[model samples]
Target: MQTFHLDAISQDRQTLAEPYHEFLRTRDMSAGVYHMEPGSHDPQGAHQEDVLFYVIRGAATLRVGDDELEVGAGSIVHVPARVAPRFVAVAEAIDVLVVFAPAESAPTIEVKYTA
Candidate 1:
């Protein structure tokens, strides 16, 4: 059995100086935690694998493609492959649990943020 504690994962990520940390990785999927401080810029670009984000805490405006939507705790968001995704105007520190289909070890598409 595999078990994880979110707090522990978050601590490890912080120790590594990364905003996102992957705790689980398999052939078909990977799960991680992404923490962002208030008013921080998202350093992510488009990925080749589909992604699912579960907002655990805090609030922010998420930009997917040309759409901007408000998101907060308990929100579930999905983004398809090769689409730009970003979190802007963060009002609080966000802790998002992220899932990527088919793992995220493969190459990704880098798209510069225009906004």
Candidate 2:
């Protein structure tokens, strides 16, 4: 068994991509922490795995498909496979916990993302 701490991980995270720190990877899933500056854009694209985003801090508007939602600390959002999500109008820097079930694979479609 293994244990992880958020603050320590956040400070020392080895970023595989800008703003996205992939902390754990397993056969069944992967996990990461995504942090954005107040006006920064999210550069991730759609993934082959279904994903969940848990808002740990900050505020922003989350868009999935044609729908948009206001999200802040403690907000949880889900996106299905092949769908792109984005966070717009970021009112503050945000940290989001991202999880992908069955891990992530190369996208078969166009690219874009949120957290």
Candidate 3:
């Protein structure tokens, strides 16, 4: 049996797409707890896998497609494969849990940003 302790993970400010924090990914599943500070926005990049975001603390504005929703503690957001979606922490601090299947096995679309 394998277990991951949140405290055991280093608070390394790793950048994924745009947001930065301690992100832990496994071989079968990718999951992480994000800490988004006020006035900070995490860049949205489309992935080839289905993803879900669970707000564990604070609040944020979720942009899924053309609709915007306010998400806070106990709120969960799901992003389907090939769907382009993004989110930003709107409150002072937002803590969220992101879950997704391994990229190699999941069907995903890449969202590239160009200037």
Candidate 4:
């Protein structure tokens, strides 16, 4: 069985322009870590596959379509395929574990940056 340690995964210094680190990928699904700084937000978009986000550290206000809620470390958020999702009002730097089923290819729609 394949094994991964979170500490080891976090130690990798690879910087992404999009604030994400893809740590695992398989035929069935893919997993990655996303980091966002305070006051920063994710671009609004939708994925082709169902996606799951597990907050690993910090907190933020997450918006899924017309709904919005506060999410903190240990919270899990799910976004169905082709549903718009975004994060905002970050109180602190946030680290989230992201997973996509059936492996994500690309966004179903064009991404829009949020200010």
Q: Which has the greatest lDDT?
A: 1
C-alpha root-mean-square deviation, candidate 1: 2.5
Measured over all alpha carbons after superposition, the RMSD of each candidate to the real structure, in angstroms, is 2.5, 3.9, 4.9, 3.6
Clashes of 1: 0
Tens digits of per-residue lDDT for model 3, 29-78: 67767677788766656667777888878877887766689998999888
lDDT of 3: 0.67
Model 2, range 77-113, lDDT digits (tens) per residue?
Answer: 9999878788876889889999999886645356553
Candidate 1 C-alpha lDDT tens digits along 1-115: 6999988998999999989889999999999999899978997789989999999999999998889999999999999988878997788999999999979965668866566
Worst 10 residues of 4 by lDDT: 9-18
**Clash totals for all candidate models:** 0, 1, 3, 0
* Per-model TM-score on C-alpha atoms: 0.90, 0.87, 0.71, 0.86
Candidate 1 off by > 4 Å: 111-115
Over 49-113, each residue of candidate 4 has an lDDT whose tens digit, in order, gives 88999999999999886679899999999998877878968888888999999887864675454
The per-model lDDT (C-alpha) reads: 0.90, 0.83, 0.67, 0.83
Q: Between candidates 2 and 3, which one is better according to lDDT?
A: 2
Global fold similarity of model 3 (TM-score): 0.71
- At residue 97, candidate 2 shows an lDDT of 96
